[model samples]
Target chain A: MFMFNSLVENNLKIISKLKKSLARPDLGAITGTILVFLFFILVARDTGMFSLEGTMNWGIVSSQFIIIAVGACLLMIAGEFDLSVGSMIGFAGIVIAVTSVVWGWPIWLSIIIAFILSMLLGALIGFIVIKTNLPSFIVSLAFLYILRGLTIFGSIHSTQKTIIGGINEVSKGDWLAPLFGGKIFTGLFTWFAEQGWIDVFEFGTRAGQPIVDGIPMMIVWAVVLVIFAHFLLNYTRFGNWIFASGGDAKAARYVGVPVDKIKILMFVFTAFCATVFATCQVIEFGSASADRGVLKEFEAIISVVIGGALLTGGYGSVIGATFGAIIFGVVQQGLFFIGVESSLFRVFLGIILLLSVIFNAHIRKIIIGKG
Target chain B: METPIMQLTDIGKHFCSIKALSNVSIKIIQGECHCLLGDNGAGKSTFIKIMSGVHQPTSGQIYFSGEMTTIESPRSAIDSGIATVYQDLAMIPLMSVMRNFWLGRELVKNIGPFKIMDTKKCNAILMQEMEKMGISLHDPSQSVGTLSGGEKQSVAIARAVYFGAKVLILDEPTSALGVYQTEKVLKTIAKVREKGIAVVFISHNVNHALEVGDKFTVLCRGKTLGTAVRGKIDYAQLQYMMSGEKLN
Candidate 1:
């Protein structure tokens, strides 16, 4: 009995230490997302509609969301928002399509041009936001509508309503497609193929496939961007200055931190990420449209808030925002597979968003102690 | 007595319609704790704000080590070897102790392009500095939020001292601390003085001011009541001047 008691005590001590170690600003968002994912799986199972293929498809769709969500998270942590991200994506897609198809430019040149254009747009937005002293929400929101209108007008006035067919066939089978959507899964596994256990699950074992590259090239992009962002935030003096600037602009200035530069960088980075995500979408669909990224701004904001970022500024994490995006993706795909009505999914999404906001508020209150 | 490291010459400041400070002059010598005592809104904050370069004086000038100069901003003050530990301490609680210590003026391996925070060196230096101050910090990696008020204040002061601040301006370091904690802060202040830095101690508590102050200046209603050496005045006299009451 004494030995058992000691064992229990040891386990309790280990758990306590683990809890202490995990008590970071981002831990709530990360754990909450995992819990929600588990709940999603359970709900799918209870509804008797759970399948591996459904999960893979959800993963593909989520890849883009995750990438953009990371950029949004960085902007949010730096105490700003980019409402133009959704529009930026559409604009990037149009730029790529126009350059590659209309101008007869090589795919590489078109991609380079798209990146430069997006980066320039981002820098412009950042400059305006910093110079005017206007709230980023209002500034970016204005950009969102303006960009959307421009995209629609630009697409309509173009020679073609739609640029159909994949870009790989026209070129020498560029490796960009495989880089973006290479998959690693084989054919479906049935109950007979599993040889027992009711074929409850069949793991993906394929190395790489085409058509969105099987892995959603966007995820790789997101991972790369997130790592870069993490380094910027945690390792660089500029990154530290960014945190300080967002934490308290007035105080940051008093301490000699270049507040304007940090704000400008954040705005530019947000738009740049948006462009990258848009390019992925264009490549994946082999088409471009004005309505390509409608309402994505709202999704990005929701992801940041759900990831446990403080809207008031000075606190947040890229990883937390990534997890928040995953939660969003799971709910989106889970609702579809559960045979729920599309409108009902919207209602559920609203509830999730509301709950996430409330959860974020509560967690913030607990962490910072009511101020 | 050592020469005054910093001297104020009839410093005055005004805010559009009101005079926040009027011809206040005082002197702080090296290795001495000069305390400024005043009631609420007695121009004590304004005086220190001007001294710390938070506000430029409307009239008069400051002489640092016998050189006349005008401080345009807080950055200028820091550049001139003057650092202020404000009431809030200007610290980010979410950040680690070492990070807070090295905020703004971080110890970077390189100057630009390839510049990065020297975390190992910073942590080591921080631990050594804290130890030298006789502070028993369990972990330099701990968040500043987890520390006591006095510890946070000590960290702020140590940070300033480490960055080569010759004139340390502490704005009520012990105001938020309890008895034991206040004692800890006082000891830290003494340690700073032992390093040959002039300390401008601002406080409402006369007893605390008396404990560590080598000289005392009383201000009331934007005017200097009087200045006295430590042994020349008592707490009662200082309190009377601080409250705008004429001493007998």
Candidate 2:
């Protein structure tokens, strides 16, 4: 009888400890990502996605989603949303292309100007939302159109067409272009290929091009941003303010938190991130289009939600959002490799988002032990 | 006699055409729980808001420590060391105790351009402050949502006191608590009183008011019915005054 009692006590302790650990908001995102990864690996082990080149392709795409999702996560943690992120990408792309290619401005200078303009627009949106007491959804939805219209209009005005080409041409010989767009570690890959470490292409080299190319600049940017955002959110005073502002703004204000300022800075950071994604794409793709990054705002928000961020605000992690982006990229490219149509990716996104909300709610209820 | 920390003289408030408050005055002193007793909409809320600087009186003067000063805004009141813990307690339920305690005024370590939170110090101070209020927390990292209602109130009280509040205003802090929690909160109030800080406790429960209050002021229809001392007034008399009845 005493032995049974001790066994029951030990089980209770384990259960309690498990419950406490699960209270962390990021647990759902982490577990969901692992399940999804295992599901794909089991079903598509023979597909090209298992290959290095195929993995790199999805990683590059996921990088774009993660760059913006990190920003969306921070803004969501601060209790706001920015639907204009997708449009900001297009607008910033047009601004850089027009300034550098059409107006003969230096590539670096054009990028800086576009960045400043995006931040100013962000500040303006934050100001209107705070001063007029309007929901950010309504405000950013308005900006979505304003920015999209300006992008298309500006492209036409500058280049006399909807698309601005020759950015790669303008970027040639510019010292700053390669850092933002070009692939790095090419020499290392070439050496590895020569040493027979990686299999060469059966079709042989095209004009002596190495089979294993270096990593894309976009991937580097995404990684650096994810780490930086994680640090800021988890280890900084501003991170506490974000959680406080989102949790309960009135309570936060009662404690003397600069709720408005934290929110405004979050908006600005979101815009800046969108601009970074645009910069990399404009330089890498060697052109800019007014419709580039269409519907990307929805994609980023979906990733953040999947990463365990609360829509009501005040709880989330950047690492979770990064994993969410990975889940998206894997499913998107994996579907194609499995011969499934890519349009169904949206259905997957919608379902994942809905399920994540439900899962997060359940976890919170368990941790809080209340309805 | 010691000068009152805050004194409102003949305060009246008019919201458009309706008179929310009229001819109400109260003096709060150091190291005392001055109970403000009233039923719902008896101008207790209006009186508290005025004291907290949420609303400026349309017809009266406010004196702080014998100085004629007007509290123009909530910011001014907080800056002057006047903290108000509303019925809701003004706490972020989703945040951890340490984060919630240091929400607005978080301590930071400057590392170049970045300012990181000093979590160790924050958690230590939070634990110490909460313990001094006679509430021992197992882990400061636990979310405030997991705490009981009365514990949450104690946290809010402790937070206000930690921020150098000279006058602490609590609005119906024990209304939602159970019998045990109510007892705990009442004890916490006594602990706060010993720190030489003035407390303006608003409650509809005559028993609760009688327990911790050194002086009790009853309000009826936006006016002061009467003020009574603890030993001088009996429970029946205090209850009658709260019910808006004349002793005679």
Candidate 3:
């Protein structure tokens, strides 16, 4: 009887715990992830979207979003926005391509230079916002136009065209290039193909190559970044400072928190992530386009919002943002698989974003009201 | 008699033509609560800022432990064992109680070459410290926003005491609390005083001040009306001192 009573008490505790967990900000993203995967699995299952190669395709697409989403997630939690993220991507890619191809510099040197310059621009924006007391949204919006204009004009002036090619050939054997542009586990995939588990090319120039070679570095970076950022925000002192800096800058300052420094560093990190994305894209495409990554900034913010971060700042999770990116990637590819118009992707995003926001507001109210 | 722990002499502040504080003098003693009472626009906050190093007095001399010094920033103030709990409490509502307890000074455990917050030690310490102050938390992982107004005040006070605060300055700690919550905070202040820490309580509430304060310094138009000890002053006298300083 005593043992039975203890079991009943444990069950009651878990029920109360479950009720409290429902108010977590990340609930929206977890729920969204489930619904997205379920809808796609039912509709696109027979289209081979779940196959190894097809999954890889959508997973890479998700990684592309995850890269930018992670940076935006941290900065938004620290109470700022970087509208220049898309433009920064285009600008950083142009810098790499022009410096490496047009200026005849080494691929490794060009990559380092592009990263440094983009980060410096990010620091400049942070300084301006802090010094002038201007809103980051407006300041970054200005940089959005400025960086985009610079990318187009600089590309046309240096190469006489908006598209610069030959980076693939230049970065082919560079020491640092593989970090941004390669696959892992090719041998494992080959073995899987040998076991007749994965599809293999039967009639190509060189046969027996698995269709899904290995996990791309892009996905690896996404997963690593998600884990690293989640740990940083949860188990580090710097994480608390970020939240405090966003929650109440004045109060934080009174308690000896360096709010200015935290904000500036977040800006630099955002630019660094943008450059990483740009580098990967340039290597994969073998060229850099002036208009590449247009509207990516909005997509990243949408992902963060769907992940349950308030636009007002100071509450979010990197894992939730990752799920939001996965939802985006799956829906983008799944609609194509199920033979739906691609334009419905945007419509779906709008509806989902609206619903997520409403759901998040409800959760927030519950949290603020009682539990 | 013991020399005051912190002494501010004729401190004055001005923003161009408008003077926020003209002439305010006070001496904070160790192991006692010094109440700086005033009405709205009574320069109470400005005086707290000056004492807490948020602002530099345009004209005055600050003496600490009988040695003249200058407090140019909040960081220097904290380094000198002075911590301020503003009306807003300097807490992140979304963060856990343990995180907020050690916001700027997190206890970290080193692993290899990296440093991360020690969750176990922090959770234990937070619960122990809060319970010592008469508030037992269910868990350290609870969000601070879920706490009552008075409980938040106690947390700030507990944090200050834990961090080796020799002088704890509280701004309007009980102005926003209910009767029961205010009683809890007053008791906490008394408990802090017992630990031999000097407390500068800034408030507009006369009854709250009279309850926990040993010394009362009334301010009117950025100037001190006078300073009186608890046995020599009553509630009506202190209330009258602030009533005449009302700004319309």
lDDT string for model 3 (A125-228, tens) is 99998899899999999999999999999999998999999998899789988888888888999899999999989887758888888888889888888898
Clashing pairs in 3: none
- Candidate 1 stretches with Cα past 4 Å from truth are A1-19, A36-56, A98-114, A127-132, A157-216, A369-371, B108-118, B178-180, B245-248
lDDT tens string, model 2, B1-248?
88999998889999998898888888889999999998888899999999998899999889998899999878789999899998785678888888888877888987788889999999999999988999989788888888899999999899999999999999999999899999998999999999999999999998899899999998987888767888998888877776778645
DockQ by candidate, in order: 0.39, 0.63, 0.63
Q: In candidate 2, residue A308 scores what lDDT?
A: 84
TM-score of chain A of each: 0.81, 0.94, 0.94
Q: How much lDDT does candidate 2 score?
A: 0.88
lDDT of 3 at A29: 89
Tens-place lDDT digits, model 1, residues A16-82: 4664455455676688778877887777776543444465566755666777887787777777888
Off by over 4 Å in 2: A1-12, A199-209, B111-113, B245-248
Q: Considering summed lDDT, which 10 consecutive residues are worst modelled in model 1 chain B?
A: B87-96
Q: TM-score for each prediction?
A: 0.83, 0.94, 0.96
Q: lDDT of each model, Cα atoms only?
A: 0.77, 0.88, 0.88
A248, model 2: CA deviation in Å? 0.9
- Would candidate 2 be rated incorrect, acceptable, medium or high by CAPRI criteria? medium
Query: Which portion of correct inter-chain contacts appears in model 1?
Result: 0.28
Give the C-alpha lDDT of model 3.
0.88
* Ranking of candidates on TM-score, top first: 3, 2, 1
List of clashing residue pairs for candidate 1: A180-A217, A181-A212, A181-A213, A181-A214, A182-A213, A182-A214, A183-A209, A183-A213, A183-A214, A184-A206
